[model samples]
Target: MKKLRLAVAVIAAAALCPFMAKAQIDLGAKAGLSIPNLTSGSSSNPINSGWSSRLGLDAGIHAEFHLTKRFSIQPEIRYSSQGGKKDGNQGFAPTPEMAGAFQQMGQPVPPYLYATYKSEAKFNYLMVPVLAKYHFGFSPKWDLYVAAGPFVSFLLNGKNETSGTSQIFADDAHKQPLPFPAVDFTRDQDIKNDLKKANFGISGHVGLAYHLNGRSAIFIEGGGNYGFVKIQKDAKNGENNTGAGVVVLGYSYRIKNK
Candidate 1:
């Protein structure tokens, strides 16, 4: 994590080097919705596979330095909400008792225990993205721009929350039941320890801005982010990647150079 952080800082500093002396710098803040999902790379691992998008909060503050009339460099510190959801019947790892019962009968243990419930894996991350932005001025008051860059994220928190009342079964066919009592899947489990702390990814944006004055502009944009690495520390948990689609509204103001 320290190495990742150092790399991001060095990259941002390198991007800012040439423009510092003359470019106009703008400071801004934005807030919006994040629609995040986990990509379950394999179907065979039922315990950590099959998930859908979940709503989350995305917000950030950034500094943009204009390098030319149409180009700029922007580096940001952002908070991202990520993860995915699964509903209905899902698989759980078998317990010791479950494995022993199958063993006593001279039967091989099944890979998972079947349960009908809902699971939402929630994650929070602090991200930094250094971007190259280009703007098209259509009018004195309006401009359209797009940006793309690589980002690094440090995980702040992660939790597995489950909720439902479902029968536990030793097989997907529901013919075999475990001896455990009625199962209740309703609790938040801290999963941060099971995940790596830093992630590397890509993020991009496309939007339009309306200049409110010579020093300020208001804009709305939509963007997306995808992490290149798997999220789990142990391969047995399943290989899942993180990503999100986002929409936000923001305002930027140039600082006076006096």
Candidate 2:
């Protein structure tokens, strides 16, 4: 009877070990700024100009599972706003042969014309990242950590806005010119159909946290996300991948292990 009772107690403790381990989970929320850009493809040029970085927002919730004294696995779900901007000037002039042809056709050619163009593309995505983190202790109250892993993002919405001004000149020699109306216009359109629905990337970050006690702390982190998959749906239009640099400030709380 004594041997049976001991055996039953051991079995009950063994069965509770997994559940007890999971009670050590930590939860946190983070919010910050992200600078995002679309990496231009080989086809990007003066005509189909490349993209530049734009400012956006990043916010997320994460769960961290401690595996050891100095290591943890963190999984996060985030809302990220990302995109790029393009701004520049382009000029066009009539060739001599073309000018002559226009004259023969009773249509005088404009000697010179130039346009200043500006455009921005905005994309919103839901992203999930699973990271492996290693912690380094500077003191009992301060710790530093570095994490890296893979992330998958789903595009929620996208838009593109363009504005430009074009001025036409009568002739290079005659700067005073005719009464040709300058063209100025702005257009905003939905671009979801033109972009890929999903994107996959590698993300990594380094941060420092200060422990207030055994349960809570504050942290700051800087990280970069680089997408390997193209974000454009049609490859023929040229490849454009997502890239972002982010900085976040957050607080975390550890749940007591049962």
Candidate 3:
């Protein structure tokens, strides 16, 4: 998107601005675990509600400009795995054939059908964040730091994976079935078309680092990102937001300008 590109350009310009002033720059790479959840909007739609977290992986590289000993600016590009899963009885739209069959029996087609199933929605994204970081010194070899900033992300892919089988139900509350055979539910549903291309949000972290030498150190950090925008392009597919918590182990090397 034009707006996302412009924002990225601004961040890149900001990173380069410190070069003329002879600032310290650090390059780093990190890899870690991601725990993602889909926060649904207020709705009775089963697709929009009742989601649980799924485990995935995340990784990235960053360039850090030291504006001062205690403060710095860091820009990062990261890959995030996000989405949610649900198991057990869930609701779905009724097919025309199902409605016709039920209608002939003097039974009106309910608004939806219920079945026991398993579903997992996985979404992949490429994210960029411009962070302001501050370091706190408590020991000669270990330092603590915190960083937070705004980020923009682009969706690379999305899908819904479903499995299991159950008899069709008119109502889950009363355990009423339509006297139908058990239906197979295993399938991969491509959801990329249902999602927006670009998203913007916030990212932050609290980290502790141990200095291996004067130039390089290893660190462990925990943080999270949340999308301010809804992911679904259609309200009918379900209104949901992308969010995840991340923990990473990373290494950084400083290129000191002496």
Candidate 4:
């Protein structure tokens, strides 16, 4: 009976050792910069012009669950700012057919006229991401990690602003400006209703962490998020996808095992 009890105790202690060594939980806050842009679908209207990346912000809190010595899962809730800029020249000249029609009417075809338009779109979102992470120990106080995950975001607000200058020339040869005053205008509008309320996407990250102590650490990371869903709802032609690259700095605290 004594021998059997000794064997049982040994086996139980062996089973519990791995769990006690590997299981840990952490919570943290993070904030950073993001470069956001839109990817337009093939069927999208060319008149809308192309998009360029815009600078934005991201901030959030995250909870990490360590399942083993080298593997973990982190879930975060973050507020993100995203959007893009569009700048181009539109309605520059009359088409060949239009010019012919003017000649037939005996109306003198006025010199070519053109307008330059510059516009920006901004969006705010509440985003949730669940990431599976793999860690590698680089030293006693430093660690390197990579993570991949999926995320969903809800749009909180959106705005669009546009400004333009229209120029008229005295002749088609492009020399001499018309005496008429140049037209300049600016407009701003809320566009929440024009955009989809929710977006779904995949995200990936790579980062390095420095442990301040057994219970605390600081980390820096760079990653990107890509959306599969269209950003707009009432699109006449194609889809607009959202994508962003992010850089962040964060602090974390490990909860003591009771």
Candidate 5:
């Protein structure tokens, strides 16, 4: 986490290198949504879930160091809430490719995979991203720009819950809680212990800004962030790598030169 913060700081400083003569330091805030899903390791269900409509809220403050007429460095620290859930039958149907694999394995056709485990997890984080933006001012008061960079997230808190039957584990089977498709796991299993603690990812940002009189501006940004960490830890000490996506929209104040 310290390394991530240091990297952002370094990038922010570098953004200022070219502008040391006449510097413009600006700050702003933003908010948005995060949509995420779980990927299954089962060859029968290789891809976990896709595009489930879950929304997350994001807000951040950024400082941009203008170094030249067209270049600047922006460093940000933000708070984000992101997660996803797979419901038994709420669009959680397995894909044809998955179904075909199950058929090949000679597994019984499920009435749906309410027989499968549907898990939902929530995550909160403090993220820092250093981005390089190109500013093209249409007039002396307004400008357009684009920025993209890498980001790191520190996992603050998370919860994992599941409702369904899964036989992935060979320990024991208790079907009283859910009777759909008898999952072969015992009640002694602790699902929460199987989740990841940190995440590393990338973000792409594009937005327009309007200079409000002095050094403040209101901006709206829409972009997607893709995380490369598996939200889950291995139940069998194997490997698990799942990721998350975020779409953001919000307003901010640019506190530097217009």
Candidate 6:
């Protein structure tokens, strides 16, 4: 499955090179802010687990090409970080039975079952956006254009981490033998692993841009990306969709060849 996904991504990128030559190529840099929203699983222990969307930063260089007078394609290489944190009173709180087992086994019981975690997942990739821009060249000083398209992004970094208490064992009995239902034991383990990294996903964008002369435009875009891959691998017991909103504000400059 991993091989298939990688192959598809390679093909998608190869298909965009020709389109680049067909459009008006503009080379420029753009910087923007990203708001990250994290969705994860639940815990039986009440250690105050919650995720927040942080304001992330993004910077990249791109080429904008006008395939047609009214249509353009933008392929960009960007480096950006997007992920949230679970902090405050968040950690692992072992049940009474579980704590007793750890004590009996002479294992070091964690002070808190849950601890704060930060996701520093970063990506460096080439993104291709074929935008259908409706240019309203009303006057020389002012022109408005509306654009929307399907954009593709690849994963360059898969860094991830998870921290929590070992609450499954009661006094080292975890090494012994669990006589109860196997599903219960599996559920506990699943939650701990679910707080890992997110898989790659797809996004769609729509926005309006106001052109400043024939070269530059500032735009604000709002949309959502539906993550086709599971963000949390072990959280099969809970919802682990990587769906996130795309909130960006920046400027694009059209490179004119002299």
In model 2, the number of clashes is: 0
Cα lDDT listed for each candidate: 0.89, 0.78, 0.89, 0.78, 0.60, 0.51
Candidate 2 clashing pairs, residues 3+ apart or interchain: none
Best by TM-score: 1
Worst 10 residues of 1 by lDDT: 40-49
Whole-model alpha-carbon lDDT for candidate 4: 0.78
Model 2 TM-score, all chains together:
0.75
Provide the lowest-lDDT 10-residue window in model 6: 181-190
What is the total number of backbone clashes in candidate 6? 13
lDDT of 3 by residue, 145-232 (tens): 9999999999999999999988888786637877778888899999899899999999999999999988999999999999988899
Candidate 2 stretches with Cα past 4 Å from truth are 1-23, 41-49, 90-114, 167-182
RMSD to truth, every model: 2.9, 11.4, 2.9, 11.9, 8.6, 9.0
- The C-alpha TM-scores of every prediction are 0.89, 0.75, 0.88, 0.75, 0.65, 0.55
Give one digit per residue, the lDDT tens place, for model 5 in 1-258: 989988987996677576653757776667766655444454333224332445566778787778777887778897866666554432224437556756787875442333345656566777777787888777877778888887888777766455665533211232323222444322233444555767777876777787776666777676666667766564332234334455555455544453
lDDT (tens digit, per residue) of candidate 1 on 100-169:
8789989898777898899999999999998889998889999999999999999999999999998888
Across 114-210, the per-residue lDDT of candidate 2 in tens digits comes to 4556778899999999888999987999999999998989999999887886554443333643344565637897989988898888888999999
Q: Can you list the residue pairs that collide in candidate 1? A: none
After TM-score superposition, the amount by which residue 95's alpha carbon in candidate 1 deviates from its true location, in angstroms, is 3.4
Report lDDT (Cα) of residue 149, candidate 5: 84
Off by over 4 Å in 4: 1-22, 47-49, 90-114, 167-185
| Superposition TM-score, candidate 6 onto the true structure | 0.55
Backbone clashes per model, in order? 0, 0, 0, 0, 4, 13
**Candidate 6 Cα errors over 4 Å, as ranges:** 1-20, 40-49, 87-198, 222-226, 236-239, 243-249, 256-258
How close to the true structure is residue 242 of candidate 1, measured as C-alpha lDDT? 95
Query: By TM-score, is 1 or 3 better?
Result: 1
